[model samples]
Target: MSDLRATFERDGFLVIPDFASSEACEELRDAALRLVEETDLESLGSTFDAGGQRHGHDPWFLGSGGEVRAFLEPERDGDRLRVNKLGHALHDRVPLFDRFSRDPRLAALVAELGLAAPLLLQSMVIFKHPRVGGAVPAHQDATYLSTDPSTVLGLWFALEDATVDNGCLELLPGGHRLGLRSRYRRDGDRTWTDTLSDEPWPSDGWRAIEARTGTLVAFHGLLPHRSRANRSSRPRCAYTLHVIDGEAEYEDDNWLQRPPTMPLRGFV
Candidate 1:
C-alpha cells in the first residue's frame, strides 16, 4: 500500500494492481450483466449517452434523477442496489461501513484514511458501455459527495480490464490541492457534469491511468478527473465505494421514494 499511498498523496489518485482478483471481478460483472439483460422496465426512462445519442447509456444501468432508477430488472430490484451494496454483499452481508467488516483491504483502506467511526456514504457502479459516445467532462467528485474533502475516498474497482483505448480514467496531478471547484451542467449529459477546475490544469500533463481486471484505483474525493468514451467493442464496468469521516446523510430527498434496500445509516 506504500506505493498507492504515495501516488494518491502526490497525484491525488493511485491504481493498485490486481487488488480484488479477476474471479471476484468476473463474478460481479456476470451479476451486473445478468441484471441488465433481465431488466424489464414498466416505465423505462430514456437512457442517453453523455453525447445525447440514443441507446448511448446502453448495456448499462445509469441511475440518475429523483426516485426513478435509470433501469429496472425484470424480476428483482437488485439492479437498483448501489455500488456500496455490491462491496458489502460481496463480503457476505458486511455493511462495508463497519470497522470490523470482514474485508481486510477495505478495513486497511478505511484505516489509512484515519477515519474515526466513518460512514459508508454512497456506492454506485459506473458502467461505461462500448460505443457509448462523449466524455465524462473533467470534474471533482466532491460536487456530488457533499463531504469534507479529506474524509472521503472514491474507490473505483474495475470489473473488466480498463485501458486507454477503451476510455480508461484520466487525472490531473495534484489537482486535489485546489479543493472543490464549481460544477456546471454539460450541454448534453444530464446524469453528470463538468467542473471548472478542468481549465486550470496543463492539458498535456493529464495522464490516463489504466489498470487490469481486478485493479483498484483509490482517489481523493475532490480529485479532478474524467474518462473518455469506450470506443472499443467492450464495456468498462466499475464499482465506486465512498467512505466519509462521520455519519453521512442522504442530502437528496428522492432516494426516500425508491424501492427500499439496505438503510444508509449516518446523519439523518
Candidate 2:
C-alpha cells in the first residue's frame, strides 16, 4: 500500500488512484442504482442509522430516465424515478453497503495516519445529475460532524468519472490547519442554526480533484471543500463515508449525536 500519510498531511486531502477494483466499483454502482429505483421518496423522514436512531434524509434528485436528462425534467405522464443521494447513515440497509463502508483499507489508513480507533457514523451516495445538480457550498465537514478534538475524516469514492464539467470536488490545500469554520448548535427544543466564520474563503488556493472510477479521495474534516453543479450531460456519482476518532466522548450538545444502538465497529 502507498504511504498516504505524508501526502494527506501535506495537502489535507489525498486522492488514491485505483483504490478499488473494477468489480467492486461496478457492484457498488449497480447497488446504488437499484436503491434509487426502489427507494420511497415519502419515507425519507424516517431514515435510520445503523444503531437504529432516526436521521433525516438528504434530498434526492429523482431523475428522469434518459441517456442525458435533467434532474427535474417533467413530462407529466410518467418517469423512471431516480434518486440523487442516500444518507446520513445508510450502511446497514444492505450487506453490500455495510461491508463497503467499513472496508479494511479505510481502517488501515486511519491507523497509519496515527488516528485513534475509527468509528464510522455516516454514509452517503451523492449523485450529481446531468443538468440540474445543485452546487454544494464551500464548507468544512466539521460543521455537520462535531467531535471534541475534531478528528473526523471523509472518504469519497467515485463510482464514475468526476471532472470539472461534472462538478468534481475542489479542495483548499492544507485548509485543515484553519480548523472548523462553522458551528451548528441547537437553540432550544427544535431550532438549530449554523454560525459561519466571517473570514472570506480562500478561493485562490482551491484545486480540482478530478478522479476516475474506483478512486478514493480522503480528506480531513476541517478541510474546506466544495463541488459545483453538474452542467455536462454525464452524471457524477460517488459514495461518501464519514469516520471519526472513537477515543473521545461524543458530546450531548452536538447536533448530530445519535443514541447508540450497537457497539462501534472498527478494523485492524
Candidate 3:
C-alpha cells in the first residue's frame, strides 16, 4: 500500500489490474445498457460534444448534476439512437451504482491513497459507442469540479476492454504537478472558462492506458488526460467516480451543483 501511494504521488495516476471481478464489471455494463433502453430517446434532444467550444450550460446538461439523464452523441447513424453517456448522479440515484460506489474496497482504497474525509462528488457512465463516439479534449478534472486546495480524485473503471483502437485513456505522466490550467464555472445563467495557465501539453511522453475489464485507473484532479474517438466496432464502456476531500471548500460557482436536498456522500 505504501508503494502504491508513492507511485501515485510520483505519477499523479495509478492503474490497478483486476480491481473488480469480471462478473461485477459485466453487471455494470448490463445496467448501463438497460439505462439506454429505458431512456426516452424521443424526448432527449441534447447532443453532448465534449470537445466542443461551448461550455455546456444547457439546462439539460447543467441540471443533470443531481439527476440521472442520458445525453446523445453529436453524430449518429441513420435512425440509430447513439447515447454518448449517462451521467452526473448514477451513484446517488441508481441502487446498483450506489452499491458499487460505496463499496468497502473503494473506501479503503481512498484511505490508502491518503484522502481523509473523502466525499463522492459525481459519477458517470461513459459509452464510447462505435463509429460516432466523440473525442474528449485534454483537460484537468479540477477545471470543472473545483475545490479549495484542489483535492479531486477520479476513479475510472473499465467495464469492457479498453484498447488503443477503442478510445482508451491517454495521459501525460506527472502532469498534475504542472498545476491547474483553467477553471470552468457558472455565473448565474452563463458558464465560462477562466484560464489559469497557457502552458501546452508536451508533444511527446503521452501514455495510452489500455486496460482490461474490471481494471481501475485512479488519477489526480490536475492530471491531463483525454481519449480519442472510437473508430472500431467495439464499444468502450467505463464507469467513473469523482471524489474530493470533504475538508476542502467546494466552490459554489462550479458548473456541477447538487440541489440542497441532495448532499454529497462518502463511501461508508
Quick one: best lDDT, which candidate?
A: 3
Q: Which ten residues in a row have the lowest lDDT in candidate 3?
A: 48-57
TM-score of each: 0.69, 0.81, 0.97
Task: Give me the candidate number with maximum TM-score.
Answer: 3
The TM-score of predicted model 2 comes to: 0.81
Residues 179-223, model 3: lDDT tens digits: 889998897667888998898877788899999999999999999
Q: Which stretches of candidate 3 lie over 4 Å from their true place?
A: 53-55
lDDT of each: 0.56, 0.69, 0.91
Clashing pairs in 3: none
* Distance from true location, Cα of 147 in model 3, Å: 0.4
For 41-87, candidate 2 gives per-residue lDDT tens digits of 44433222211112222222111100111122111113433344565
Query: Which residue pairs overlap in candidate 2's backbone?
Result: 61-84
C-alpha RMSD by candidate, in order: 7.6, 7.0, 1.2
Which candidate model has the greater TM-score, 2 or 3?
3
